[model samples]
Each structure stands twice: as C-alpha cells, then as structure tokens.
Target: MAAFTAADVKALREKTGAGMMDAKKALDEANGDMEAAIDALRAKGLATAQKKSSRTAAEGLIGLAVEGTRGVAVEVNSETDFVAKNDKFQDFVRKTTQVALGLGNDDVEALKGSAYPDGGTVTDKLTENVATIGENQQVRRMKTVSVGQGAVVAYMHNAVSPEAQDLGKIGVLVALEGDANADVLAALGRDIAQHAAAMFPLALNADGLDADVIERERKIAAEKAAESGKPENVQEKMVEGAVKKYAKENALLSQIFVKDGKATVEEYVARIAKEAGASIKLVDYVRFQLGEGIEKEESDFAAEVAAAVAG
Candidate 1:
C-alpha cells in the first residue's frame, strides 16, 4: 500500500487544484513523497492542458501594452467570462502583454516559448493556470506595432481598472511615423488608437486591404449589377464603383472619422499634423476585440440537468 494518508491527498489537491482522485493517484504513485507528487501533478497538469485544448475558449480579455515607440496587443481567451474577472487570470494577461512588448514581434507561438516572469516558459505557466483555474485558457493572437521615429500608442476599451488600463475587452495599438514631439505624437497616436478600437478597420488603407476580401466584394457587386439588367459596360462600371466604395468604407485611412464624422481618418491625421507643426504619418495599427472570430460552444443548462438526473 502507498504510504501517503488522506491529509496528503488533501494537501496535494489544495496545492495543485487537481481533482481528489487525481491527487490521490499522484500521491500513491509518488509513494508519499511530497515533491515527487508535485512533479507528478505538474506532468498531469500538462496533460490536462492538452486535453482541454480542444475545448473552445471564446471569452476573456484583450491585453495591451506600450513601451517607448513599440506596442503590443494580445488576446487571451478563457472558457468563460467569469475567468476573465479572476485576479490571477488578469495578472497573467497583463504580464503576457508586457512580455510581448519586449519580443518586438507579433508571433504568439514565440511568445509562448519565451520565459515568463514568475518561473517556467509562458506555455508552461499557461498550462499551470489551466490546471489551477479549472478552465481552458489560450493565448489566441498577438500583434505588435512600432514606428522608428514617432510613437506607438495603446488604448483599451472596457477597461477593468483605471490603474491597470491594459486589461480590457478590446485593445488597439496605433503606430505613427514622423519626427514629432513626444507629447504631440503620443496624443495623436492615442486618438488614432481610440479611433481604431471603435472603427475596427480591416486595413490601414485600401491598398492594404485583403485581396480575397476585395475579390469577394467584386463578385458580390457584379451579381448585384447583373440583377439590375444593365448593359455590360454599365455593369462593369457599377461593379468597379461598388468595390471602391467597399474598400473606402473598410480601410482605416479612408474610413470616415468616428469622432467628428466630418473627415476621413487620413484627413484627421493631416489636420493633427498641421496643428502640431509636424509631418505625422499613420504608419500602422492593430486592433484586437477579444475572441472576435471564435465560435463558442453553446450549452443547454436544462438538458444538462436532465441528463444528470437520469444518470
């Protein structure tokens, strides 16, 4: 028989947040050795992360951070919204965004492989978090934006706290290029970032818009034109006009400014530049709305209760 007692199992469960059966099994496997049991539980936790990976993680927070002229936005997803409110989860999101800012690249896989502040690799820490938090968590996506001579500003929508403004439901980073004064650049960049968070533009400009998206728009426009029974030449003109309008509406620079609605984003930047007496260029931007494209699994609480009773 294993040498460990009931108290050991309880302690192991408290330490690792493993199920009672899992804790007892690990303790038995370790032959009452506490450290060995911990190692076993950690290994099991890694396995648990793998098992939970297939579960949809469509709720959580978008974390944003800026350092000097560089900024990063990250989307960390949890299985439920409740997990997003967890202090530990918020801390992890904040720290992960900070780590991402240092990386200087927007690669999520590389960020996961990077060292975490507390101890292990970021991926390892995430696995441990899943074990402790009792839910699947994912570092879904990350984006970094930087300007060589200007500023990268970050903005968070639905901020949880004024102090920790980086944790929120939506995050935006705008990179402005030019030799403007630091204060002026930061102010302009913040405004642009805020606009980005609200507008959710598909690209910085029409030229930067996705080719497939343009093609899809073109196809839809052609179909619409066909329904009008227009001449072939007129239909061609109509399709081209429709595609251009779609691009203008979806691209950041061409989109109407959300603030005053009197000017396009490009015009707004030009106006800001003239006022600041500097040539400011809207170089790039990134916006992340938490779980924007993820489809969450729908649960039927009544059915679940019925099944439990039947079982």
Candidate 2:
C-alpha cells in the first residue's frame, strides 16, 4: 500500500466530506487512486461532509462545559446562523469544547492539532467539515481554566442557540484558588465572571497592570498636573497621585464593585472568601467578546442585487 501525501489526502477529503484520516484510508484502500477514494467515501455516505467544507461558516456557536474541577469554552464559526441552529453544528461546538477542556491549552493552532474523538486530528476533521459543509468554517478560539484546590467557573452570555448558557455576547472564565466546593464556587464565579464581562477590567490586580498602559496614563496625568500651575515638586506628586488613581480604576481588584459601586473588587472577594470559609485567590480570568477586533467586510446589499440582475 502506498502512503498518501498531504495533498492526496486533502484532495480526497475535498472530494468526499470525510475526515483526512478517512480520506487517506479510502485512498489507501483504493491504492492511492482519487476516483477509487471517492467511490469508497460514497459507499460510506460520509462524502457529503467533504463537499460542504468549502462554504463560509461565519455563524456557529460558542460552547461551554464544566466537569470536575475544570471548565472549557470554545467558539466554532459557521457561514450562516441557520447552520448554527443545525443540530450537527451545535454538536460540533459541544465536542470542540470538550476537546479544548482536555487539551488545557489556549493556543488555537494547538487545539486544532489536538486529537478529536472518533479518529483523526481536529484539524483533519475541520478540513473534512469544510468540504462537506460547503462553507469556510473555523475553530476560532478556545480556552480552559482549572485550579489546584479551587474551581474554574464559566459563563456564556446571550446564547442564541443552545450554546450561550448564561448572559449576552461575552464569555468569561474566573479562576478561584482555594478548597471551595464546585457548586458554591461556581455560583460566586458566575456572578463575578459576569461582572468582569460587563466591566472589562484591565488586570487581576494593580501589580499586573500593563507597564506601557501605566506609562501612557502617567504622561496624561503629568500634562493634567502641569495645567494646575503648581510648583515642579508639587506637580510631580500630583502626577504620581493621578497615576495611582488610574491604576485603581483600571485594575480588577481595585475597581469598585459594579453591583453596589461601594466596595472594591478585592474587598468583595475577601467577603466571599470569609463567607465560604476558604481563602480565595483571584489567579486569572479571560473574557471574550464576539468579533471584538475582526473587522467585518462591509458591503452594500442593494448594489450586489443590482449587479446580479445586470449580469
């Protein structure tokens, strides 16, 4: 049996909506013959999955799952919202989230290369899906959160499909460090994560604040301080004080609680820790807003229609 090259596998996969491994299997079974591989896929009825892969998959689902001491979140994109509503697409999202949780890596490329259930690598499966679905789909991003003694809680906002389980467009993961029970910590975590999504804090604490961001603020503060016409030393002190205020405002632990707008986040977490009888440490968190930086291609629908008619 001849070994199939990547191009051979890709071409076979494109012809039959089957995964890369499946395509290779077919190709190998066919003795590296492309037509034979297509016939092999047709016999299996999985060829359609390959045919649909070329279509754009822009609208899909964000999936979240929590098990044991860890939680995972994943974003799988499809070409249309209709596909997102499809049970098949939803299942893909769910499975992808589970795969992401197991990998425990934040890198998208790594996750794509990670093993997928039912054979073949995730990348291979995605390629087959692209061909089968007839749309350009993507595994956009993934993240996992876990702790030694604590719980990592997750919340998905505005679930249009069965995907978004909690709130709006924001998905968050908050890690609490302590021996807290999953149920109790999860409740608190959801609230805190939701707050984080709403507030968009810059860092877990003042110490973790970005140095460049701090410097930029310092420059702005110095300019503002100079406007007061104070002495050089006094202006310097004022600028320093201003920088401190800026840090307090942007840093997560220092930000005032959004719910009550009274106590700082640190104080609030302290209160929770006391109530829970476990020391809680805010290790880190992640918040993702759909299409945050991706600039969508803008187009005029009417012009498109006119062009189609003219053609």
Candidate 3:
C-alpha cells in the first residue's frame, strides 16, 4: 500500500505544482515524508513548477461552447503562442470549455474542481498537462450566458490559423431573449457577437461599465478640461460629459454597430426585432479576449547577459 494518503499527494502538488502522479510517486518513494518528497521533486527540477506558474501565460486560445440558449466562454492561457498551437493544449482547452459549459454558470473554482472527461479532476489534468507540456498553463476565467426564452450565439475571432476552428484569441457570446424565431434570434445574435468581437465593448450597457474604469475616464476628462482653462462649473460638466461619452463608446448597447456604421447596437437589435415579430432583448453577453489584462514579461537581453556572466 502507498504510505501517503491522497490528501498528502494533493498538498505536495499544491506546494510544488507537481503533477498528481509524480507527487504521489515522490511521496511513496519518501515513505510519506512531505519534506523528503518535496526535496525529491526539487532534485528532479519539477519543484520549479511553482515558479513557472507565476510566469505570465498570456498566449492561448479562447475556448467556446454553445448549446441552444446557453453558451460558455473559457480562457485557458499558456506561456507562448507555440504552446497554444500544440494539439494537446488545444484539446485540453476544448475539453475544459465543454466541462465549463456543463456547469451551467461561470464559477472557475468549481470548474477546476469538476471532473475532467479523462480519468482525473480538471485540476489534476491541468497539472499533468503542465508537467508533460513543459510549460505553465492556467484556466483563468469562464463566463456562461443564457437566455430564458431565446438563443445564445457564439463567434470566435481571429483564429490562429486555418486549422484552428472554433477557437480564437477572442470568443464572444450574445444572448438574445424573446420568443421570436430561433433562427432569426441566432442570426441577430451572431451579428451582434461578431460586432462585439471586433469592437471589444467593455460592458453590455453604459451603466454596466466598471466604476474604476469610469473614474479613470473622469480623471482624464477633468485634467483635459482644466488644461482648456475652463471654469470649475464647466470642468465639472465636461468631466460628466466625457465620462458619459466614454461609457457610450465602451458599452455594447450604445456603441455604433460596426456592420453598417449607422445604427447603434441597440438600434440594430430593434430593427432585427421587427423581423422576429417580437420584442428582443440582449439580456447578457460575455467576451473573452485572451490575456486582456495580463502583462507579459519581456526578456531583458542585457540582464540575461549580466546574470550569465555572474554565473
């Protein structure tokens, strides 16, 4: 019998970021000694997994899965675009998105805990994948959108290559709610989703914009207005006006639809609604632009040369 329990293996894996099987094997070899197992992993260089996990994983595909009225978008990031192109990595992302779609909501922690289609949990699989692929990967975020009565459409933008189907750097889902024709709803949602993919709307509506984002815009507007030698009252009005304009430009509903450049997104939806013969509402949406906020580390050649010389 193995001397270590599954919890011991899990702890070791968490501490060292080693894969489940390797952690268990190390624990067994160390006769259930946590410290000894960690040492063993360190000697094998697998203990560096924890450090690798901290590296920016800003290059990967956005995995998307849509089923009828519901759709899920998952962002699985890797250390390099080369890894993103790996079949195993792509397969892992695709399976992860499928698992997330089954979860019915966008809880990333729960998704990680959920069982993978393979023999182990999603986290276990991810850890093993990282070890085998020799690169750190992260299942960062997932969003699930559904409509009570309508259709949710999906669009993937800028597929890495011709072979990369149904996966892209940007994945968008648009849920349109109404009892209108499903086909019509799907068509309209696809159009909207494509627009979202191109335009990169920050939120569904002006009010949905983040407070921090709005505040940042306000600060910029105030500074610019002050530079105009404007009075306090005018500056205050200018700030509000600029903030409103920012919100309008960044929100999906108020932004001009890119397809024709004439109608606002909401207006485009209303025009489609007339064809559908019912009221249509874009109730929810999710846009997963890969690595949107992650700051990738730039390799410093001078520092590398200095460190090498020191070594």
Candidate 4:
C-alpha cells in the first residue's frame, strides 16, 4: 500500500513544482517524509531550491508609513481577498500602521494593545473589524527602520488597488545612513527600496543569511556534487562553490541590482554615495511580501468538482 496520501502528493507537487506522478513516487520512496521527498526531487534536478516565501495564501494588506528618517511596515491579515478590498479592512490596517509608527516599536502585541485612532485599543479595533467584516483578521507583525543621518525610504509594490495607497502586497523600507543631501538620499533610498521589492532578498548581507538556510543549501549541493563522479577533493570544492553561490544570490548586498543587472547592490549604493559626495551605508531594510511563511489551506479540486456534479 502507498504510505503517502493523495493530499501529501499534492503538497509535494506544489512545493517542488514536480509533476503529480513524480511527487507521489518521491513521497513513496521516502515513506511519506515530505522533506526527504523534496530533497530527492532536487537531487534529481527535478525541483528547484525551496522558496522561503512559497505560499501566497494569506489574503491581506501591507501598510507602510515613513516619517522623515523613520519608517514602519505592518502586516494585517484577513481570510479572503474580498475582505482585503473592503474599505473598512483597509482603514483598520492603515490606522494600525500609523499607531505602530507613532509607537516607534516593532512589537506586534504592543501595537495591538496600543490605542487606536477611533477610541479603542488596536486589538479592540481588530476584533470589531473581524465581527463587522465577518472575517478573521490579525495584526501579524511589524518592523521599523530608521537612520539618524540619512533617509528611510518606502515603496509599495502592486498596491491592493489605486485606492489602497500606502498599502500593498509587497512593502519595502530601506534605511541609509550618510551625510548626503535629503533629496539625494531619498532618491537613492527609493531606488534601493524598489529593487528590494523586486529581488526579495533574505538578508542585508551574505553573513546575515540564516544558518539553517545555508546548511540546507549545502546538503542539497553535496547531494548533487556526489552525482558528478568526480574525485573527493573536487566534490568538496563543488559543494563549497555551490553554497557560496547560493548565499551570494540570496544576500541583498551581494545580489546583482535588478535595475542595472551589471552592478551588485553594494557597488550600486557605493556609486551613488560617491556621486552624492558622502560615505553612505546601507544600514538595514525590511521587505514584507504579504502571506510570507504562512501555510495556507488547500482544497481538493477533484473532490469539489465531484461534489458539485452530484449536487
């Protein structure tokens, strides 16, 4: 009997981009171990690296606020896109974000407990919204970035709609520190923010990348290297090279700027700094793509169709 269920096969297929049969076969080989099956698919070059932000199932909006050198990003989640487009829901996110910005903190629980603009705590307002909108809502997370000497620029990619200004699917904040003019810093910061939205870098630099992520890449690279039929030393070099390449690509500063393609993001920033006659540093950034890291529920299309036909 097959050890994995049909749903397991479906999930494996979604995660690895493998065909249904391939996912099922891989899962069977691994005795229903999802991670092991994923590795098997990648070892055979049938699957790509795991996208950390794989599922976009959580419907929500990202609220952004920038006050001079300080900026904040707040993610408020709802159950459906219908609720996301609702005016009341968007207003809750916008007001919550402003409250967070005023708090100048990164604590979601604190922001939830803080007073809302409409004479209630943020959490009170959220509960009210959920009841009034007839959908579950949550203040998932928030982050703030600031630079004393420079600028904290903001960018929203694919705003929920034209009406949802300062709220979007992807919100980015970039903090640059330097003595450059405000206009120069704002321009450069916004360009970097836009790049961040497109690139979706995992960390500010290669060294800041998560150790678990690096180790997983190493394991996958080693498995692929073993297939080369090369000497042990060559295999070691290949594995290290692959790991380094993965880190370089995932790290924000080491990535090639999406704008020019030729220049690395670090080099691009440096070039701008030189032009502005200041030593600008990319201090920090936040790239909040809606529904990141959320495991969304899935349905069986076959079952649903069968049920509808029977009905």
Top candidate on TM-score is 1
- Candidate 3 global TM-score: 0.82
Tell me model 3's lDDT, rounded to 2 decimals: 0.88
The TM-score values for the models, in the order shown, are 0.90, 0.72, 0.82, 0.77
Ranked by TM-score, top first: 1, 3, 4, 2
lDDT of 4 by residue, 1-311 (tens): 87889999989876756678778888999999999997787665411211212324388899999898899999988778888988888888999999999988898989988999999899777755543454567789999999888889888999977766699999999999999988888888888889998888999998899999999999999999999999999999999999999999988899999888899989999999898789899999999999999878786889989997999
Highest-scoring model, lDDT: 1
Question: Which regions of candidate 2 fall more than 4 Å away from where they truly are?
Answer: 1-60, 78-83, 161-168, 226-230, 303-311
Cα lDDT tens digits, model 2, 210-254, are 999899999999898889999999999999999999889888788
Per-residue lDDT for 239 in model 1?
99
lDDT of 3 by residue, 1-311 (tens): 87889999999987766788889999999999999998787666544556688888999899989887889999999998998988888989999999999999879999999999996899888877776576889999999999889888988888766766568898888999988887788788889988998888999998899999888988899899999997899989989999998999999999999997999999989988897679899888999999999999999979999997999
Q: Looking at model 2, how many pairs of residues clash?
A: 35
Cα lDDT tens digits for candidate 1, 38-73: 898888777878898999999999998888888899
lDDT of 4: 0.85
RMSD for each of the candidates: 2.6, 8.3, 7.2, 16.7
- Identify the runs in model 4 with alpha carbons over 4 angstroms from their true place: 1-57, 299-311
Pairs of residues at least 3 apart in sequence or in different chains that clash in candidate 1? none
The lDDT values for all models are: 0.89, 0.75, 0.88, 0.85
Better lDDT candidate (2, 3): 3
After the best TM-score superposition of candidate 1, give how far the Cα of residue 19 lies from its true spot, in angstroms.
4.0
